[model samples]
Target chain A: MNETSAALEVRNIHKRFGGLEVLRGIDLRAGSGDVITLIGSSGSGKSTLLRCINLLEPPNEGEIIFDGESLALRRARDGTLVAADQQQITRLRAGVGFVFQNFNLWPHMTILENVIEAPRQVLGYSRDRAIADAESLLEKVGLADKRDGYPAFLSGGQQQRAAIARTLAMHPRVILFDEPTSALDPELVTEVLAVIRDLAEEGRTMLIVTHEMRFARDVSTQVVFLHEGRIEEQGPPSKVFESPESPRCREFLASHL
Target chain B: MRWSVILENLPQLLHGAWLTLELVLVSGVLGLAIAVPMAIVRCSRFASVRAFPWVYIYFFRGTPLLVQIFLVYYGLGQSPWVRDSLLWPVLSQAYWCAIIAFTFNTSAYTAEILRGAIQAVPEGEVEAARALGMGRVVTWRRIVLPRAFRIALPAYSNEVILMLKGSALASTITLLDLTGMARTIIARTYTPLEIFLAAGVLYVLITFLILGGFRLVERRLNRHLRPRTGH
Candidate 1:
């Protein structure tokens, strides 16, 4: 409760699918300008944790305090979970951006329209301001020239960068990246990492779940290694990578890193 | 094959074509109005919300269009409640009854086409919209609806052409559309083959015209799929 200064705090979050527990009592927090990279083997619940952060897959049991306000949730009659206060959830989501592995850009819209859409429709930005911000974000992501092109025409790397620009257009306080490079070709990884590296350099708060160890080691201020749906070890990247206390962490790092 | 009889009926046949065009046009526009919302509702999470449209699509699509026309025209007309209602004046006319029946029938098919298209849209884009804080309504308007409409275009065009042919059934109700005029001409001139052949050709011409219009729309909407000119 005293961690109100943090931009995001997840306390004892638990998620289950049928009888399988995907995430079990996980705890995490991110402060302003903190770049926390979560490294885990596939199915260690990394993506589910990221999704739970934004209530995209609302956790069965947890507290998600974003920007100091705890989320309000209710159990539906069918024993399903839903946000208790929809308006507040909307406001909370607008402040937190999520980047998907596949770059989920709207295929029907041009890059510029895709980038400007959330700002205009969700945040109520004026057309002029949304376009202006979108242009600058595109420039930052090195995609200014491709603003008018549809997603189908772009390279996988270019599409991922465009997705980043779209996320940046929201001016989010905290951004969640769910394995942003997993869907790209090996050669396309660096361009996206470069964009994210720049965001980290700008002192933006980010929570990244990635398999790219070198990039995580390079960009993360804090590194977390998850094993079997729990954080096995977490600290400065040097400690987690160089001298992991947990045997599971060392085993995971040996295999993936 | 009397040249004099054929020449004398040309003007009346053209007028019938005009009436048939009006019926198709009115029904098409009105049907779209019903189809869009009903399609969206069909994808709703609540069972009760989806039930009405499911039954509507089942009833209209399952039964014959001719039966639908008869039910609306004769069955509804025979009811005392309908005869005494505010809509009685409009319902009493065969023209309005045909319009009502055609609109209802076409709307069901269009709704099903659109519902399939809407569901076919990738779940990723919809999730992305929500991740960016878009409400359900905004997500549908900006993302779901437009993309689904593009996907539904070819199917919708077919539905309309079918409706254009189906509008011929209005003749059975005494609306005197293209087929009705052909029947009248056959009765007077006793040339069933010539009169029916002429009517079939007129229907083919209108179908081609509508197909051309839809092609233009498809081109405009799908310009995004075309490769960029310079790069």
Candidate 2:
């Protein structure tokens, strides 16, 4: 829960989409084996901060340090910070897995192909090695039978689990979940969350942005409450959920919880 | 409409059909080979990278195929610098000139078709590729281009059919393609109706075959989209 064992640390992230400032000076950290859940209402910048960790939506200002290495950064013409080395950013991204709200599985590829593609192409693993890694990961996520199926054929929950397996195939140091169950039908949400719960129980490092209050409270070691593009409060899940100091945090959590 | 005249010239007509098929097939492959890369360049992020290809595609798609043939054939051959250059050997031959014109023309149309298809790829799917750490080239080859090809297939088949017909212009440039061979036989035997009809029949046949080939490709590329026939 502290900085000493931090696997991923993002300091003072600021992101602007045109005139709209989405994330303003947010600092987040994930230590080894920690499950940090980000809870906020829609438009509170939870998703944007999750995306900024991998620089998928590059923060205009921030220092991202992954695996104890600081990301090489440079100032853009508009005074926004950008990754100085594209290769480095890509390399770092491989170390951080991301699961989206929409699954976003490659429709043209089978689940097995989708999972194996990154390890093979990005990490330059041999075909047999990648397939072995993918098969085992798929088995872990209970998607072993669905390996040959396409994304469209599977239900939303199944696809999200497969997406998780796809992320795990690379053995990434930390995984980011951006509302993994938000797109699922209410009945289907439990299966995907159960899969995520299993990952959390296994002591995997994760940062989750979610709307599911009970799941967050149950699974998270730490909870961060974001309000209008800034961190209203963050601490142990019990403290933030029960005795939040920030009135905004208490108001938002009470509304959702 | 003497059947005798048609029968007598059938052998010569077949030879001309063979030439037409060669022209269409080779250029179809060559043009697409050039087009895939050109389309990727056409859709680049940098305006500077986008501009030159824009002009290349514009000029080809803008002018008539006949004019393009002439530009490569007579226009280039006539230029003193071109005549004196290393390309003169290929430029001097009508066969190569026709191929050049058709290749360039089709490459432009194909590139434009693929550009639209590439852009039409779902933004989230591409974003997923980025988040996976696949580099630009790897993402394009493994994710973008294959998906684009699936979307581009129908429009691209239309381009191929148009190319088949436009290839009749090859005869106008002094190559003995299907139309050209038909004209030569008609001149000899004075049988325009039979000769023209035969050539038209052949063109329709090729069109049917092209459509069939595309259908097979579509089935293979889109097998994932089809519902499971019970596992």
Candidate 3:
């Protein structure tokens, strides 16, 4: 891909927790309208890699470039990459939205409040404008009637949809999902995946770490297989799932399927 | 047993009851202020910030409130430097000393209660706030502290009632609080049972008022969690 066409680029990213190396020398790139699905075993660093994209867990080494800006790279007085300040990283994070495994909705807030909070507080939208935008987004996610309810009162699927609405309200360029359906009951998983499918249809760029093999195969434009902190194989889902080139990918798919 | 005797001493008991209410009000407000910051420090990530309140809470909570009152009233009074210091003007007064002792004693317990509540706030909520790009101060104001205070409220109300009962210790410092007035009446009239029973009634009334106030606050704060009528 050309340098200007890439929406997100991870170059030689490494993350470690003391003795444990969670991600090792990982590199990836996604185009503006691409839906990249990462599939792997439980501790293969798929979620950790997604979190690193937002600087939620800063990588121990390497750089993450979003759009044309370097998210993990700091420019010096002479305009060179060094170490980014935490403040700049936080500002960069505003450009990316994340959906957690457990549908981390703010329980204290109404569904409407949860949707509008980031827009009003982070983006400095006025109350009237934020509410207007939030209502439309809630309607988009099919939660317009549940706007006044607390998250606890909602089903798992409903909460996940509300979470999607909350993230979309921020108008983030890239949305990340960390196993968005893992915590849901088997029956509820389809509804959450359906919302994700709708987001993909709208040409919203997405990076998802998930265990749902069929959802990945059906929805992903690209699929990455991660094993033991490394990308074992990756390509179009038709290629990766149907004809995984690597022995590790074959083993992983065999175990899961 | 005479109704006339009870009526004659009613004025003195009422005055003391007023003093007891004053003590509880002053100490409860001061205690909450001290507790919130103390609890924040107690749960801090840094070793020093965490250690400071750990010691403060341990000493204050480990010791009996009665002993703490005696130590402040008598032990500090025995110090020549304390007696001569500029602070002596305030500390020398029995009322101020009692307030200081009660405030400190209740603060230690309240801080622990608050710390548990603050810690009990789900990790997901904090993560959600951070993801919203809220600064530490705004997140604390909008999310953390409010929820923490809500969780701590029940325990705090119990502490307030305990502090009201604890105000009885103020009588030991020669303050003419409710229990002090009751003691005086008992000594003069030699009707310990009748006079103390009258004082007990006043305390029950005050406790009920406090309970009512907390119920109102709890209902308002938890309104969001209540089920909606139409939905």
Ranking by DockQ: 2, 1, 3
lDDT of 2 by residue, A133-193 (tens): 9899889888899999988889999999999999998888999999999999999999899
Q: In DockQ, how does model 2 score against the reference complex?
A: 0.78
lDDT of 3 by residue, B190-215 (tens): 98888888899999999999999999
Best by DockQ: 2
CA error at residue B82 for candidate 2, angstroms? 2.8
For model 3, the superposed segments whose C-alpha errors exceed 4 Å read A72-84, A255-257, B1-8, B74-89, B224-231
Tens digit per residue, CA lDDT, model 3, A1-257: 67898888888878887779999989999899899999999999999898777766667777888787876565444332343566665565677788999888877789998888888887889999999999999898889999999888899999999999998888888889999999999999998899899989989889999999999998899999998889989999999998999998999899887
User: What TM-score does each of the candidates earn?
Assistant: 0.96, 0.96, 0.91
DockQ, prediction 3: 0.47
Q: Which stretches of candidate 2 lie over 4 Å from their true place?
A: B227-231
True lDDT of residue B225, candidate 2: 87
User: By lDDT, is 2 or 3 better?
Assistant: 2
lDDT of 1 at A208: 98
Candidate 1 deviant stretches above 4 angstroms: A78-80, B1-8, B226-231
